[model samples]
Target: MTWRFALVIQPAGVDDDRRDFSATFRTIDPAEPALSVGELSTQRGDGIFESIGVVDGHPQEVAAHLDRLAHSAEICDLPAPNLEQWRQAVARAAEHGERRGEGVIKLILSRGVEHGPAPTAWVTASAAADFTVPRTQGIRVVTLDRGYASDVPDRAPWLLLGAKTLSYAVNMAAIREAKARGADDAIFVTSDGYVLEAPTASLILKFGDRFTTPAPTGGILRGTTQQSLFDHLREEGYETAEELIPVDLLARADAAWLVSSVRLAAPVTAIDDTRIELDSGLTQAFNRYLLTPRD
Candidate 1:
């Protein structure tokens, strides 16, 4: 049977501008069976989405995120959201969520919502989830040898792996595999041993006196936090490079860190059981730069 669902709106208040925006859903009946965000498998999965952290009621790098979302929707052939309408809707949900002071906001757009066995465009918002910085102990991660499914052809041929899309099953599965090995996350690596990125975030590391991250060309998302750090550090005379990174070599580096919107900056003390120097001049500078409040 076809299912219905409700769009849950989280209002913005407390510190936001108090503007309101509404998102959507099908209003599925609670009596019916349910699948999870990571469990849908029957339909052609074609959609786009992004998650941004709300800091003191503001979404960090808000303009860049909106631009990326719109670009991703275009690449996936999803209907363009009326930017004006979308802005207002997100504003409303944030206001209703009352998580404006400190929280995370997820903006999702699906072209797989069906009315009667056929999918249609639908946009929705989840209630604001809690946001907190992760610990400094750092996360352990595994490297994935293959991307997506081993056999199925890539649907979004234009899929910019860097764009935040809702098609995250592969990423989730990679994390599971990493965890089975006692790691906290997963990293995607090319067959030749070049580092692509971690499952959900961008990877960055220090090699001697320089800081580097995988190029977006290698399927790594150009992260806002990474971008912020690059710019902030460059002003301080740190050289940043965007190029192919050999996985084996990063293990021999002075230090490494994976960056994200909410997790902020997490340093890596070990990789595949190999220990790394966790404290250094570069990492200390990064810590000082990252601790500043978001611009």
Candidate 2:
């Protein structure tokens, strides 16, 4: 990805005076090195992040992304991010880009350097990858065991399963494992046999006129894109829901998709070796709505 803009943020406490809020952001060269070697984000992946899709220079779903960022911070015991400060930062970062076509804005808040006095924060804007083929032609996925039960989130809070932390090594490994097995992506399933989510995206399955995603309760990051699409689907007179999904149900679904911020909505053409019929009309409608600018 080619970064077009970068800004280092001086995060403010919730109670801090905001009269000089603009001063909290400093523009920087995206190609330059601006982080310390001992930063916890680099050393231990101790941080939280959010990727907001940008369409024609407008950052989509700012409020939802910010809310998730705060939720992740709370889960990780990191200091609460002043939403107002981050909000302005996102707008500023978006302005520096070419403001055309599709792009993305990523917000990051780290635990900072080991033994340091404060946290580290920044934002970067860059052009998004071309996902036309995946969005139009669809992708094939394989299921991998996540090595835990569906109730693991409630049973083990210390694992930080629901937070969108910087610790994505395992998720990346899962995708690589899928590719090695002749698949495009991987869907994580509980050891006890329940559907979870894709490594970096939320899984949505359609049965007749009803659509369902794995309930967000079990360590799955609440997908902002999926939530928005659900609203759109509901308005179009389709039923949408979040519920526990059994692994065997993948074969029974009429259609399915793996949705995320940058990739938008990608239809799942197959699971393991089982073929799924792609709903071309619905997929096009979904991307048409997503490509439009939304606050």
- Computed on alpha carbons, the lDDT of every model, listed in order, comes to 0.60, 0.93
**What lDDT tens digits, residue by residue, belong to model 1 across residues 1-295?**
1211224323222244433343332333335454344422235455666666555455566665667777776666665654554565445434444433444556665554344332233323333333232334666666777544311223445755555667778888888998899888777887667888887777888887798898776255668778888888789888999887777877777877877766666777677878766664555566556545555
Question: Taking the tens digit of each residue's C-alpha lDDT, what string does model 2 give over 266-294?
Answer: 99999999999999999999999988887
Which portions of model 2 show Cα errors greater than 4 Å? Answer: 1-3, 17-20
Whole-model lDDT, model 1? 0.60
Shift in Å, residue 6, candidate 1: 9.6
For residue 295, give model 2's deviation from the true position in Å. 2.9
TM-score of each: 0.73, 0.98
Q: Candidate 1 has what TM-score?
A: 0.73
Off by over 4 Å in 1: 1-42, 97-101, 115-133, 147-160, 280-295
